[model samples]
Target: MRPRVLMVGSAPEERGGIGTVTTLLLRHGSRHADIRMVVTHREGPAAMRLRLWLSGTARVAAALVRGQVDVVHAHVSERGSVVRKGLLVLLAKAFRVPVVLHCHGAEFADWYRGLPGAVRRGIAWTFRRADLLVVLGSSWRNRYVELLGVLGDRVVAFGNPIELPASVAKPAGLKVVFLGRFGDRKGSAAVLRAVAGLPVELVMAGDGEVAATRALARELGVPAEIRDWLSFEERDELLASAHVFVLPSRDEGLPMALLEAMGHGLVPVVSPVGSIGDVVQDGENGLLVPPADAAAIRQALASLLADDGMRARLAKAARSTVEPFAIESYLDELAARWRSLTG
Candidate 1:
């Protein structure tokens, strides 16, 4: 019989990592078994498949009465979602379902890094009951084990899953792409500053920071082109035609855009933050520089543009490196883990 599963979250219904991962698991869970979702807000393409609205805790109690819910995958972000997530985890346990906590923030540790011992203990205690805690990087694992006192066995290092194209990258013009929200943490302004006076076209996608990025571009006298958030198909077109994908983020959780670019064989130049080290591999798949360092970012872009063969080689290697972290494997691993928990 297929195991019933519940994925709870704040914007669990949104079209981001939390939604995407939950969707992937549900899709693959059926291959070996069966699973369902319980989302606060049903978001993303997968919602169309097994869409659920947040019936809240009342639903968890209601579902338990109906039958066994094998597992609860709680996806949490840093900004005030923890209270809701923690409450749900407690509820899942009461419902007799095993719990897996997957964090979406890159600076998970840093958020509590400077807190006092009592405060940190108080915070860590909230998640101590999880059967499993999923972090994308080894560093994050270490942080949870060492600082948070989560057992080593409970932590799993998983990367952001991307669906890579089988085709190799074709030669394209000097296209520099920045795909993310136009926000301060993303350093959209820095991207504009770096590309100013440079003889290259920039494709800036997403909202929020568009006005600021464009303003910076105009003030710096750079030829920056702004586009709305690209759809999956449009993103493919852009990555396929682009020469470089640059994400100068002050924060990240292995940005999906970076992996998607590598899937299409575009070299990445990003800040050395989050699980970026899990994929960037510096000088290997892509180049990593200090956060907010526009001068260094610009230099790296110039260096890659000057050497097409080098960029192509890295992109090829990147594509290969990311194959194991593909969506199919991600689903399989997650489903297997969920089954193991239920059993």
Candidate 2:
């Protein structure tokens, strides 16, 4: 029988990168493993989340009592997420089910280091108890080792994966796209400062500080297409037509947006945060800029706008870079790891 896996994280219905990642993993991972999921958290009022925590713990305990779960895959961030999932990890250990802690938070290093020494040590103890820790990129793997003092062998990095479209024909017009929350963390404000007067049409998709972001664009007298949210088809159409994908996030954990953009063959102009620098090499697969730098962002966008040949070269290379991260390969690797852990 296939090993029974329980994935604990944000509800798939939640509207954020973590939700998107969980949805993709379940969709693609089911083909290779017997995976089940429970919601430890969801997007809503704080009161709702509190109820979920109580109910989620009950459900996990029930599953453990029935011996239906062989592995527990807990996705976690810092602060409350860490504390909650740390309890789940200890619970899973008590039940003799191996736990896989998938670290997805972008600001984890800063958050952990800022904690009081006692709290930091407590967090580290929880981390050290996990059977395996999955990170989005090698940089994060190093961070976990250095921060928690966990063995390097137990922490592994796997890029987020997605099912690829058969083909993406270049669409007409110069379209620049940004697919993420609209705030400083995503560097939406910086992107606005950079492309305020650019010739290309800037399409900002995703919600957060919508009113403020729109006001800034108007204040700068730049025409932009700001959509609160895009359906899957709309997102696909936008990426296919886009010539450049920009994300100058102050922090990120291998953003799904950048990977998706690269898969769609849009040359990425991104910050060197998280594991982004692992895939996007300046002047190679894509361009990398310092986080939250408007001038640098402007220069990168300007260069891509003026040189069609350069864009095409980077686009081709960017598309190739995502091949290894294809959903099938990701599933294979995950299944292999699960098998080893269970055996």
Candidate 3:
């Protein structure tokens, strides 16, 4: 029988990568294994909030008690760990089944980055107890080891998977997109600054604390398109017409936007953070610039605008780079890893 995995994470309205990853896992996971998605928070239409909670947590937990679940994957950190995720982990421990902790935040390091004394020791202890700890890149393996040294052997670096678009998007040179939340870490402000004075039109496709992003665009006099939210179809249309994809996040855990843009064949100009090394390969697949450096971003953008060949080559590579992130490959590797761990 296929192993039954109970995957848990935020709902769709949260606008985070974990949600995307979880959705992709379930959509593909069914092919190889029995999967139940336990969404732990509210998203989308307000009226359905209560319904999702009962169906997701209550109905799912009852199934677990009846021996329906074999593995429970917690898609959040241990501290901010919600009730649904925490309960599932405790249950897995009691049942003597394996549990997977997938950490996607840049804050994973911050949890014990430079700590001292007994508290740091406690944090290390919790990490040690994790059956399997998953992270974005091998570069961070040692850092995780520093804190969870005892579980070092159990931890693995698995790059986040993304869906490839049906075909490479044809750039009209009339549009550009920045598809993450507005904030210092995301550095949407920097993307705005980099595109300043350029003839190309721009759209900002998320919402956050920065009312100033709009003001900043106005001050710099760039024609701005701002949307509070976008449907999946609308987002695809934006990606289709966009000439370039720029993610100026100061820190990232392999931003799905960057990967999806690559899937859609939009060249990326991104900061080298998390597992981005797998996605952006400098002048080869896409552009890479120092995060928070508007000048570097501008220069990369200018180069792409001037050279059609460079843009086309990078776009082609971007689409191909995401071939590994397809739904099928993710499910195959995940099932193999689960069997390996449990065997």
TM-score for each prediction? 0.89, 0.97, 0.88
1 versus 3: better TM-score goes to: 1
Query: Model 3 TM-score?
Result: 0.88
Better of 1 and 2 by TM-score: 2
lDDT for model 2, please.
Answer: 0.89
Model 1 lDDT tens row, 115-195: 778867766886888899988778778777897788899999887777767686576568889988887788888788888
Models, CA RMSD each: 3.9, 1.1, 3.3
Candidate 2 on 1-343: residue-level lDDT in tens?
4789999988986766678778888988877788999998977899999999989988999999999998999999888999999999999999889999999998899999899999999999999999999999999999999999999999999978866767867976678899888998999988889988788889998988989999999999879888887766788888888889999998999988888889999999999889999999999988988887899999998998788899889999999999888888988998888888999
Backbone-clash count (model 3): 0
TM-score of 1: 0.89
Where model 1 places Cα greater than 4 Å from the true spot, the runs are: 10-15, 26-29, 41-54, 114-119
Please provide, for model 3 over 89-123, each residue's C-alpha lDDT reduced to its tens digit, 9 standing for 90 to 100: 66567667778878777666665555676766765
